[model samples]
Structures are given as structure tokens and as C-alpha cells.
Target: MPSQSLAYAVLFGHVAFIVVGALMTVLSQNLVRALVGLIMTLFGVAGLFFLMSAPFIGLMQILIYVGAVSILIFFAIMLTQSWSSGDEAQGPSRKRAVLASLTALAPALFLGLTIIFKSPPSLLVAEETEVSALGRFLLEPYILPFELISLLLTVAMAGAVILGFERRKQR
Candidate 1:
């Protein structure tokens, strides 16, 4: 078993990543910077999952969010003509920024309060969930939501392709 100090250090690091990344995600003017921040946030979440003894979830967090989703966002931004390197300096209006800040803070505050006030649940032992069990759960009982998400991604990709082609044709 790891020492208490070491575990605390790791937890602190993960929380730092989560807080900084989340701030960057919402605060950055640049879209790519925001995307990078989002990836950082996801990476932090993966770290937390690993700490909780959920390696499968951590792997999925890194693979799906940091890898695929980030790449997709990068590609989408690259393919767009509206957003360029120069435009990164230009930020949204003050009203919009305040609203966005409030939007992000509200949920975070609620979560913090909930954690503070809630009593711990009683359990005999913390069960370790296997990746195979998760796979079965996704494919069996939650198949509809899973399939719907896949379909949504497919449609988004198709739309992006069509939009890219149209933009190229016009240029």
C-alpha cells in the first residue's frame, strides 16, 4: 500500500489539473486552447478514476475524450474558415463572458455543496468492476443510448464533410 502522503500528493495533483483545466476551458479566448484545456480536464478525470481503482474507466477517459474527441475538435476547427490564428485574440462580449462564467460556476458550486452535505453510503466492501462487465452493461441494458450516441457522431461527421466540401467548392 502507498503511504498516506504519496496518495495525498497524487490527489492534490489530480485536483490541480482538474481546476486549472476547467478554468482554461472556460476562460480561454482561443478555441484550440479551450479544446486543449478540455483534454487536460479529461486527463485529470482519468487520473481520478485510476485513483479510485477504475483503470478501465481511466483508459476509456484517455482514449475516448483525450484521443478521439480532441482530434475531432481539432479537425473541425482546422476545416473551418471562420476561425483562424489571428482571430484567437478576439474574445466574446463582456455580458457573454459573465454569463458563461456564471453557467460554469453554478454546477461546480452545487456539486461542492452536495459533497459537503451528503452522508457516506454504507457498503460492505468496494467492488472492483471489470471492463468486461461494463462492456456487457453498455451493449445489453443501455444499448439504445449507446447506439444513439454512435448515430449522433456519424451524423456530425457526415455534416462536417458536407460543409467542408461546400466551403472548398466556393473558394
Candidate 2:
């Protein structure tokens, strides 16, 4: 077990990773760079899950979000070729930057105010949950939804590929 201060430091670092990655994702003009930032944010979230003693969730986050989703997005971006031509000529608009900053800050501000006003003890307390129970519940009761979501993702990927091919044909 780590010391309390050390744990706090690690938590802060993870939070910083999430913040910086989010900014990078939102602000970057390049699709590939934004995807990389998304990966970084996902990794930071996984780290936080591990720090909270949810190794299963952490691993799932890495496997699903970082490995699968990010790769899929990267592939789609590559296929679409949207990042290659006109992106460099146009810089980010000042209005978009201001809007993005405000959008990002709103949730943080709300959370901060909630933390300051609410009871910390209540916020800290969480119900003890077994990983096996969670797994069983998802596998048993939500299996249909799970399969449907997978199918949906597959369809979406196919659609993206088709769109990419169509765009290429048009050109």
C-alpha cells in the first residue's frame, strides 16, 4: 500500500493526464492527434480505476477504450483521409476555442462547487461490490443488450468503410 500523500500525488497526476488529454483531443486540428489524446485520456481513466482498487474495470478500460475504440477510430480516420488536405490551411477559430474552454470548464466548476458544498463523508462512502457479481449480472441479464451493442458497433464500422470508399470513388 502506498502512503496517503503518495496516493494523493498519483491521483493528481492522473487527473492532470485526463485534463491535458481532453484539451488535446478537443483542441487539436488533426484527427490523428485527437485520437492520440483520446487514448491518453482513456489511459488516465484506467489508472484512476486501478488506484480505486477496481483492477477489472481498469483492465477493461484499457482493453475496450484504449485498444479497441482508439484503434477503430484511427483506422476510420486513415480510411477517410479527412485529415490530409485542407485541415492545415485552416486554424482553429477563436470562438471555437472560447466555447471549448467554457464547455470543459462547466463540468469541473459544477463538480468543484458540489464538493465544496456537499458532505465529504457521504461522497466518499461506496457500497462494497464483487467483480464476479458484476460480471454475472452483465452476462446473465444484459447479454442481449451487450450483443446488440456489439452488432451496432460492427454496423457503424461497416458504414464508415462504405462512406470512405464512396468518397474515394467520388474523387
Candidate 3:
């Protein structure tokens, strides 16, 4: 087992990456940059899964999220029209910014307070889940939902392509 301090350090690093990545994803004006941030966030989550002793979930996170979704987002960004550079003057007004921040922070604050106030759940022995078991579950029972999600992504991509061409035709 790793030292306690080392474990804490890993936790801190994962949390920091998640926070920074989430901020970049929400705050960046550039679509490509946001996609990069999303990839970073996904990687951080994968690390968290690994830390929690769920290697199968961690690998799936990297494979499905960072690999497939991020690549698809990057391709979509590349295929879409480019936007002007982000400028301070072009940003949202202070009032709107404040409102948006509050909108995002409120639920987070509530959740944080709830967690802090609530009694900790009873500890249970962790069960080991194998990747093969998970694969069978996904393929057998959840196959329809899984395939639907893929179909949804495909439709979204097609819509994006149509919109991109429409913009070109308008110009």
C-alpha cells in the first residue's frame, strides 16, 4: 500500500486538475480550448476512479470519454466555423457574470453544506468488479441504451455538419 501522504497528494492533484479543467471548460470562449479542458476533466475523473480501486471504470473512462468523446468534440470544433478571438470588452457584462456565477455556485454550495452536515454513511467492504463482468452487463442488458447514446452522438454530428454548411451557404 502507498503511504498516506502520497495518497493525499494524489487526491489533491486529481481535485486540482478537475477544478482547473472545469473552469476552463466553462469559461473559455474558444470551442477547441473548451474541448481540451473537457478532455483534461475526463482524465482527472479517470484518475479518481483508479484511486478508488476501480481500474476497469478508470480504463473505460479513458477509453470512452477521453478517447472517443474528446476526439469527436475536436473534430466537430475543427469542422465548424471559426470565431473571433476572445477579448475583455467582448465578454459578458459584470452583472451577467455575477448572476451566472451565482447560478452555478448555488447548487454547489447547497451540496457542499449538505455533505458537511449529513452523517457519514456506514462503511462496507468493497466488492471487486472485473472488466469482463462489466462488459457482459453492458453488452447483454444495457446494449440498447449504449447503442442509443452512440446514435445520439452520430445525429448530433450530422446536425453540426448541416449547420456548418448552412453557415457557409449564407456567406
Candidate 4:
């Protein structure tokens, strides 16, 4: 077990990762770089889950968000050929940037102020459930929905690929 100070330091580092990654994701002109930033943010969230002693959730976060979702976004970007265009080079107008910044800042500032002013409730210890039980539950009653979602995703990917091929053939 780590010391309290060490844990706080780790928590701060994870928060920093989330913040920096979020900024990169929102502000970067390059689609690939934004995707990398999104990955970083997902990783930071996973780290937080691990810090909270939810290893299963942390692994799921990495497996689903970092691995699956990021790849899906990357493939979507590639299929759309959005990154190859030079339109982003022109950049957003200063007024638009200011508006976007303010739009993001408002919620953050409100949340920060609420946290600072409000007295937090006592933390409750969560009951620890075995990973095997959770797995069994997911695989049993939820299996059909799970399989359906997988099928849907597969079909979507196939459709995207077919559309990409059609586009190529047209050009």
C-alpha cells in the first residue's frame, strides 16, 4: 500500500493527465493528435478507477474506450479522409476561440466553486464483489444484448468499409 501523500501525488498526476489530454483533444487541429489526446484522457480515467480500487472497471475502461472506441474513431477519420484535407490549417477565429473557451470554462468554474463551497458528504465504503461473479452475470442474462451490440458494431464497420471502397471506385 502506498502512503497517503504518495496516493495524493498520483491522484494529482492523473488529474493533470486528464486536464492536459482534454485540452489537447478539444484544441488540437490535427485529428490524429486529438485522437491521441482522447486516448490519454481515457487512460487517466482508468488510472483513477485503479486508484479507487476498481480494477475491473479500470481494465474495462482501457479495453473499451482506449482500445475499441479510439480505433473506431481512427477508422472513421481515415474512411472520411478528413485528416488529409488542409481545411484545419486556417484555424478558428479568435472570437470563436474565446466563445469556446468560455463555454468550457463556465461548467468547470461552476463545478469548482460548488466543490469549494459545499461540504462533502462522508465517503461510503463500497461492497467488494468478485470478478468471476460479475463476469458470470454479464455472460448469462446479458449475453444476447452483448452479442447484438457486437453484431451492430461489426455491421457498422463493414458498411463503413464498403462506403470507403465505393468512394475510391468513384474517384
Candidate 5:
């Protein structure tokens, strides 16, 4: 258990950053600022992971998320054809988009709140230390899902390559 003072600081600080980061992600006009906000959001999520007693997950989130996803987003920006001046207004979306997003968000928020309030506190399952344990599970029990994830990664990489090549070829 954490010291009361320490826990309070961590929890409140994490929550504050999460809210501010979410606002930054949504409300920033500049794309780069939005990306920075996304990075902050990821960092705040990683902090929450640590608070939940999974330091390993927190480290992995920082390493895989901030390290890879942020760079990928920047690369995607550079690979695009449009380089507009910052002065142009990002006009509001059409009515259909507004309606569609709200339609999705309303149920999502409701379900999220319900789950948060209804769930029992979680207990930590014991950790197994043997490397062979994972191998046995992965190859025997979880083979289908494992291969599915691999296949998805392959398709995603191929799509990224095709799009990237097309952008450069047209330029």
C-alpha cells in the first residue's frame, strides 16, 4: 500500500493531467499541438497503469506507445501531400459526422460509467516466472489469437507501405 500523502498526490496529479491532456487532444487547432497532447495523454495513462500496480505494463506503454506511435504519427504527417498554412480554418464537420459521433459517444459514456460504478475491485492473479510457460500457452492454447495478431500486423504494414509509396510516387 502507498503512503496516504503519496497516493493522494499520485492519484490527483494523474487525474488532472489526464483531463488536461484529453482537452489538449480535442481542442487544439494545430496538428502538432494535438500530437503533443496525445503524447501527454499516453504518459498520463502510463502513470495510471503504474498506480494499479503493474509497473511492467506502465513501462511497456511508454516504450511501445510514446516511442513508436508518436513517431508513426509524425511520419504520417510528413508523408501526406497537403501542406497548408496554419491560418486556414478547420471548418466544422458536416452535420452527419456530428450526429454519428454523438450517437456513438452517448452509449459509450453510459456503458463506461455503468461499468466503473458496478465492477468489484480487482485482485491480482499470481505471476508465473518460467519462460517455457508462455511458450506452451502461446503455441498450444493461444495459437489462434497469436497468429491473428501477427496476420493483422502484416496486413497493416503492407497497407502502410502501399500508401507511403503512393505518396512519394505522386510527389
Candidate 6:
């Protein structure tokens, strides 16, 4: 009933929403449902970042994940034909999905136990340092990577055009 408890409750809700949304996205067979779950997860993560005092990161999360990444994915999905040949290729493979779920769980469980047992030093206090640190790294140590990504994007665009426009030789 107290203010602190209310804050904790809200934070827990965000965390729960994020976890559920992420799992739904991963598990869903339908593309549109997965996209919806991904969007929910993105917004939930943005809320978490905001609570962690990185408002800039929250904004970037929304812009990069929801605005750009999702749109790019949606465009690719749109370009594909919706025809399902007999049994749909888009349907989930139960065995592969189970195997993948188990594989992911192993690492997650291990990392969780390690953190619990090792008891890493807690900051107990975190402030908004993400933007400055991210900016410095982007302009400094990661400048080459940034330039390489740009070059890669250019190459990919050219490749897409070549694939899209190429005509097969007629016999």
C-alpha cells in the first residue's frame, strides 16, 4: 500500500511483460503475432531502460527496435507471398523448437546460477551515463566498425538491386 511497494510492483510488471513478450515472440508460429510480441517486448525493454535512468537508451530502443528493425522486417515479410503450400513452411517444428528452447535454457540457467553463487559486486546505484559512454565509444574505439557497417549496407543495397532487376537469358 506504500509508495515504495507501488514502485516495485510497477517495475515487476514491466519485467514480467518483457519476459512474456519475448517468449511469445520466440514461440509464436504466426509472423504477425511474433511481430506484435516483438513490439511489446521492445516497449517493455524501453520502459526498463527508462527505470534504469537511461532515457536516451530508452529512446534509441524505441527508434532502433520498434521503428527501424521492425519496419525492415515487416517490409521483408510483405515482399514474400502469403501462399502456404499444403502444410505451411511457416508452421513451427516441434522437435527443433524444443531442442532450441532447451539449448537456450542451459546457458541461461548456467549464467543465472553463476551470478547467484558468485555474487558479483552490485553497483546499488546507477546513473545515466549510457549516452556519453556510447557516444565516446561510437566515435573512438568503434569508428572502424561504424564505417564497415556503412560499407556493408552499401554492398547489400547493390546486391539487392542486382537480384531484383537481373533478367535470365532466354534460350
TM-score for each predicted model, relative to the true structure: 0.72, 0.71, 0.72, 0.72, 0.72, 0.75
Off by over 4 Å in 5: 81-88, 91-105, 122-140, 167-171
Q: Which 10 consecutive residues of model 1 have the lowest summed lDDT? A: 80-89
Off-target runs (Cα >4 Å) in candidate 6 are 1-3, 82-93, 130-137, 140-142, 152-163, 166-171
On residues 41-127, what C-alpha lDDT tens digit does candidate 1 reach at each position? Answer: 999999998888888889988998888989988887787733536566676798987888799789989998998789587553347
lDDT of 3 by residue, 131-155 (tens): 8998899899999999999999899
On the 0 to 100 scale, the lDDT of residue 53 in model 1 is: 81
lDDT per residue, candidate 2, 1-171, as tens digits? 368778789899999999999988877878788888999999999999988777889999999998888988988788778683644437877898799889979998999899888945553323546889988988999999989999998999899788768744454
Q: How much is 10 displaced in model 3, in angstroms?
A: 0.9
Model 6 TM-score relative to the real fold: 0.75
Q: Provide the RMSD of all predictions against the true structure, rounded to 1 decimal.
A: 3.7, 3.9, 3.9, 4.0, 4.3, 3.4
In order, what lDDT does every prediction score?
0.84, 0.84, 0.82, 0.87, 0.78, 0.82
Task: For model 2, give the 10-residue run with minimal summed lDDT.
Answer: 119-128
* Global Cα lDDT for candidate 4: 0.87
Range of the 10 consecutive residues with the lowest summed lDDT in candidate 5: 80-89
Lowest-lDDT window of 10 residues in candidate 4?
Answer: 119-128
lDDT of 5 by residue, 110-154 (tens): 999999999888754334344476578789989999999999999
* Model with the higher lDDT, candidate 4 or 6: 4
Please give, for residues 54-129, the per-residue lDDT of candidate 6 as tens digits: 8998999999999999998877666673323323346767898789889999989999999889997876336768
lDDT by residue for model 4 over 30-137, one digit each (tens)?
Answer: 988888999999999999988877889999999999989999899978877767265565678999989988998999999989988896785533466689988898
TM-score (C-alpha, index-matched) for candidate 3: 0.72
